[model samples]
Target: METFSIHPIGYVRERDGSKVLEVLPEYRPALDKLDEWGHVVSVWWFSGSDNPDTRSILRQTRPHQSSPGEAGTFATRSPRRPNPLGLTVAKIDRVDVEQGLVVIDRHDALPDTPLLDIKPYSPGSDRVEAPILPEWAAHWPKSREESAVFDWAKEDGKA
Candidate 1:
């Protein structure tokens, strides 16, 4: 069978080195041509968190508690789904080759989240006309602190 390898463009500078992850050095140069895309899709690995040890976790999580029926992993945005990959449609806040950084809209990921790869977020292709998201996810309660977490991650590196 043909083989494949996953590479990263750069580490996420979110937590000021507290939660850092290095991208494959070989793919570091690929970022040179990425600046043209204003926003890129960040497909990173959740190196810290994995599928929960419990089998019941596979059942519908929050939706079941609220909706009264267990949902499948694929239907909900549960983290314990198959492959355990985290897909965030993040914006290209900044890119610095010298320091090896790809600053993004930092809220979706945790500090030290492993940098797997980055793809351009193309409005013409990436967007869906009518997204049928689950009922539980239709409304996310955003607070001042929750919304500002990414801002801190994107803060100036020099300052």
Candidate 2:
């Protein structure tokens, strides 16, 4: 197999209870005009889950109560896959291109997580008007705003 290299262009940070993506000085230029977008797709590394055992996991049994009984790692957003990469669409709260900082509404990645890349969330390409979903997750929130107040614990079988 061919190997490739990946590097962090920034790190996720938490300041005053807000999630922030602090781009490294060298990568600051990349943030130019990023603030024009209302939302961005953040690609980050699941550093905590990166291990031989986790990487070897190919399947998960009932990873989520609202998910299928069993699913391949790829089918579900399991961090324990061949590559522990995380992708999230976060609403932009603020962006300081000069300071190389992007304050986002929310993200699932932990503080200090390595940020790989950021892409503008273009509705033209990213949105699906009538995407199909599995029966189990059909009841989930339809948008990120709704998800913010959603009863996620119930989906995890914790509530």
Candidate 3:
């Protein structure tokens, strides 16, 4: 077996202010020019996951927040898996060099998520064709224009 090691460039400070991550010192150098970008893609490890005693008996149902469905850990975004890794794209709301951290507008990741890698979300550099998704997954629930309408209706309660 081969062993590997990694360090974090920076950590994600959630908008709510209840969560924080201490990025590894070794990888701190990578943050030199990171904050200039408006948004970034974060690849992290679910370090705080409540790992199940038996991997074979992991849950296959979706959380209460989503529609009921059965899926393997790989099929759904379940953290309790062989490798508890997660990826999220978040807007860079603020950066604090002195504090050694950056704030993201939105993050579903739990506290203590080990920051693995960070990449700028530049359209010219990261753009790609639509990814192949599972049949059950819906590609972007609404369009940008439709989202505006939905947002307005949600606030007005006129939907």
Candidate 4:
């Protein structure tokens, strides 16, 4: 198998209770004009879950109530995969180019999580007009804004 290397360009931070992505001094230049986009796609590492055992978990039962009883790792967004990477599309609240800080509305990453990369969220390519979902998840929210208020715990039968 071919191997690849990945180095974090920055780290996620918590500033005054707000989530922020602080790019390293060397990568700050990449943030140039990023503010023009209203949202960004953050690629981060699942640092805490990266391990031999986790990486070996290829199947999960009841990963989510809306999912099948058992599913392959690729079928669900389990952090325990061949590659422990996480992707999140976050709404940009603010961006400070000089400081290389990006304040986002929310992210499913832990503070200090290693940030792999950031790309402007282009709707033309990122948004799907009609996405096919299993019957179980057909009732889920249709938009990110709606998802913010959606009761995922309830949908997962954990509420």
Model 1 lDDT tens row, 1-159 = 575676545555555533333445677676776767877777776655564553235665344333435667677555555456777765566666545666665436676666777778787998766666556544432432354543432322222
Model 2 has an lDDT value of 0.91
Residue pairs in clash, model 3: none
* lDDT at 80, model 3: 68
Q: Give me the runs in candidate 2 sitting further than 4 Å from their true place.
A: 157-159
- The whole-model lDDT of each prediction reads 0.58, 0.91, 0.60, 0.91
Candidate 2 lDDT for residue 146:
95
For lDDT, candidate 2 versus 3, the one ahead is 2
Per-prediction count of colliding residue pairs?
Answer: 2, 0, 0, 0
Which candidate wins on lDDT?
2
Positional deviation of 120 in candidate 4, in angstroms? 0.4
Off by over 4 Å in 3: 7-11, 14-26, 50-59, 62-69, 124-127, 139-159
TM-score of each: 0.67, 0.95, 0.64, 0.95
Off by over 4 Å in 1: 1-10, 15-24, 51-57, 64-68, 134-159
lDDT score of residue 112 within candidate 3: 60
